[model samples]
Target chain A: MPMTRLYVSVLLIAVLLGNNACTHYYYAPNTLQTPFLQEQHDARASLGMISGDEFNGYEVHAAYSPLKHAAVMVNHFQVSSGSGSNVSSSEDSGAGHLTEVALGGYYPVGKYTTFSLFAGWGAGSVSNNFDFDVKADLSFQRRFLQPTVAIRGKWARFGAALRFNQLRYVKGEVDVEVGEPDLTIIRNIERASPLFVPEAGLSCGFGYQAFWADFNLNFCNIRDRDDYHFAYSTVGLSFSCQLDYFWRER
Target chain B: MEKLRIALPLFGLLLLAAACNKKADFNYYYYEPADYALISQHLNLPEIPDDYRAQLPTHIANLGLAARPVEQDKAILGRVLFYDKSLSKDGTISCASCHKQELAFSDNAKVSTGVFNRAGDRNSIALGSVLNFSAYYGTDLFGPSGVPFFWDNRAGTATEQNLASMTNPKEMDMSHSDIVSAVQSKAYYAPLFKMAFGSEQINSERVSDAIAEFVNAIGSYKSKFDKEAEKAIGYNVYSNNEYKSFSGFTAQENAGKNLFLANCASCHSPTQSRPAKMKANNGLDIATTDAGVGGITGVSADQGTFKVPLLRNIEITAPYMHDGRFATLEEVVEHYNSGIQAHPNLSEELRAPGGGPLRLNLSENDKKALVAFLKTLTDTELIADTRFSNPFK
Candidate 1:
């Protein structure tokens, strides 16, 4: 009887915590694109949920159903720091890439549409940029066409998406012109706060599912420049997997 | 009844529209100009000239200034840039390395020093009357506001003048990128770049203008001679004939001043003078290793010629003459006094026959008073002005 009471109390506590903890709060401005519902491939692949019978080189679709349609989905990024760049050198970041860990949760309201918001932080030496809060913005994924092949038990979906992001450097404000203009002195200047830069990106991903779990992966261009993606786009790829326990209700 | 029902539906739709239009929660970001230190003092000459507006286009056409206008923020940014040694190959020297404010903005050494302590062949001249100097030769795309800078009339425009130091190999010894890194690293200058040029990127013309503004800021108008001339003081000593005449004068000093007016004024007139303001080729050396003006223009008539220097703070800018050949003002005066050499294209003022009319010979007393008068031209207040002190320390 005591263990039964403890079990009920533990479940109640989990439900309370799950309800109160701020899942990555994302701000979905009306201008954001709608998430593609038919794009189940990315939603599943991000969680690395693929069936044993799945084949390589062939795009696949995956599905995930939760008791509550508005539950938040988060992404984790492992990030690092301490890799200072050579300010005078025109070189690329060749050091062993550091992991910037991040945790973000976004919400989806329907099968064909999703308006998700997330606030996460990533810090690595390669970032080189100053940060206000390792953060991200809302992404609207819409499933224009849901590719469905003859499935055995679980259903699947696949498509692409458009994302809008913001990068900030408010913590780096600097005082530039405060000092006296004495050309006679050399080396330093007036000080001020650090600088902040804003950026945008475009992405496409796929997903898969099985009796046990669901997974997905997404590749995107994450630069803030207007036409920086004109020639060769820098890519950001995310991989994720979720437990099959959430599907027990089915 | 049907018409009333349709109208009521439209009213309901309008009401819903207004409800949706109500304000929602939001966040935003804003930027403000970053502050910086002024390492050198400036005199803010001639209101930047009304025509200075015209100089903007040529500057914008260049890749550097196209990023920012020649406006206030850039002027301030240029001040800091003028003093940053990181803009050089080695961080020891900077734009202010040679153009010191205490020395009338000119270097105190004979030949200007550069990175690695490499010395230039010519003396570093003070920065003033730049807008009033000679014009350009049109070898490249020059700017509206330009002037003659070096001993030779080499650089034609302010833009060119700004670029000269980078290429000189002895001065700044840097490309635009190195300066950009040095500036952007300050943690403070990133915003200053935005304040001055509205961007966080740095370039050369901006570097030149900042230095130029600080340079133009210091002037010789505060001299006792200038202050008295401006009526700030009572009818001063220079206004009296007793001072200029033989009354208690060093005979050599009077002779030197007379010789100066007759032979040197053609080019090296006081800053207050106008027109072909002054360019000279004193019959100093017959066969010259330093080609002077001729080296710049490739003209035979200009051989061994050099810009006649302003005599404002000549005492401190010593190691006199273009090559800094004379260590003392006495040696310089005596060079023309009895040692005028014969050259094929020497100035007629010094080359007149009859033993070259050695008329500059004077009693020692004459030399003393003249030196004293020249001393009065030195604005001691300028050298000690705290406004131009180093900002780093």
Candidate 2:
């Protein structure tokens, strides 16, 4: 019974992670494409919205099958969010924005499943304004690789993916302008070791005719050189249209 | 039908995620300044002067007393709570009832009277001046090794001390919940609490924090001694040998200062170099009924040991000692002069070379000089500062 309870707990955690919001500042795993090549020249374009506790953003994705067994895909994501506050302005606000781009390939595994891989890079910047004319800014850059697998039925699809990322903090500075002595603190983070981030994702979708909508949930565990680990999660919904389907006769 | 099976679960998950609404984003700006004018008008709070935020002297900082800066809003809120009688069960007593600012924040009574005029066990200790009690007692002085508060040192931080007093049967005679409800019921507390903590959630911890801030801000650095010392040797007079001569003092006052530095400075140095290490059995009695620190520790050597109170404004804080047995500073000085008892656990400083009670055998003039020097330590500014005075008036 205890083992059963443990299994249920794990399943619940997985479901929660799968339904969480997007990674506004961090790398997230790419969603799986179940049938990589439905036809020799199959092409699909998707627009998605990602939402998380820390960020809200959008993603654009395009995939085209050049061969009967292989397909190429490209995606772009942008997210922005804010937190904290500023006392002088009577505004408590700190904001961050992230931009990421990726290109990948997929290979059909069976009649109903496919495997895909992607490599991506992202850049993010955050700024905070505090009381007494104090402002802090931080910039980050990261690279990631993801592998995924998916199974597809006539109207539904289920998939999972894992993303491995390396992150580097580019710059962090704080500028204070109060009273006589103005001070600017530029942190030396160049010597800081890169962080290793491991991410996992779950995706599901249903479609009718030429349009399809899907949900993707990604969870990432980031570990710094000091071995401190932090976890972040993001959830996204994507809408896509198979353009060739409408052009071809039934 | 098949779509419904997958749609319901997914819908439920989305609802759960939205319900969580976890605050994970980094906030860029923080600290919204409260409407101070509104708070002041509602609570009858006085405006804090720029001098109230004065920096500690370099000499005092060199003494290793850690600094705990108090926010102005928090201190103002704390002042209200300090004087509010609603903190007591019967609405008759507050923290300031015993720790009056005029008497260096110590009660003139031997032991302070609590709710229902109940007498406490130990004399109330002075907690005034620019010295940060929380920094001294909670962190720097003896806090690293877990020193407790009060005469017996049963509590730890100022927060713990306030909570203990509030819940003690002999003190405020109110439970933690009762204190919270009382503050919550006061309409004036709403804006003050919101200004201090960014919320109006009246709880015990926030109450303790505000009170501690006010207590920490009751500093007194504008004494005659401070002026004389600063003029003679500048601000960094902690280790200046020239200033040790008491250059600006009168002949008798200088003589008394020299005597104090020679005899009492080991435990009561104004710079706080050699603060009492835990409690010491100050040879108060051969056998004490009040076990003091020993009662809490359950150790034989600790029996009759009590914390050494700071002597910042000792002149007005009389009725001295843990039990407040001595009524006058002369009598208190005379105890060290010739009246030390031969307790087995007598502090080593008061022990004779042959292991009996150490006697000063001082002349009457020397005793008088010592008393005169102690009076110089008084800071009239602290006693008269409207910032530390009751705002209810």
User: What lDDT tens digits, residue by residue, belong to model 2 across residues B1-393?
Assistant: 445434433343343233322222222222222544444555555432223454555556555544566687687788888888889987888998888988989999989989988988888887763255545555433556644568888777777788888877777988888988998886668867876787888899999989877776776666666667656544334443643555678878877877787678767765532255667778888897799988998999888999876577888988899999999999999999999998888988888899999899889999999998888888887888777777774
lDDT of 1 by residue, B283-381 (tens): 788766677888877888778778766676666667777877888877776786777776555665666676353356655665654565455456676
- In model 1, the Cα lDDT at residue B228 comes to 35
lDDT of each: 0.42, 0.66
After superposition, the stretches of candidate 1 with alpha carbons farther than 4 Å from their true spots are A1-250, B1-72, B128-146, B232-264, B270-278, B353-359
Residue A175, candidate 1: C-alpha displacement in angstroms: 15
Judged by TM-score, which candidate is best? 2
Interface RMSD of candidate number 1 = 16.3
Native A-B contact fraction in model 2? 0.00
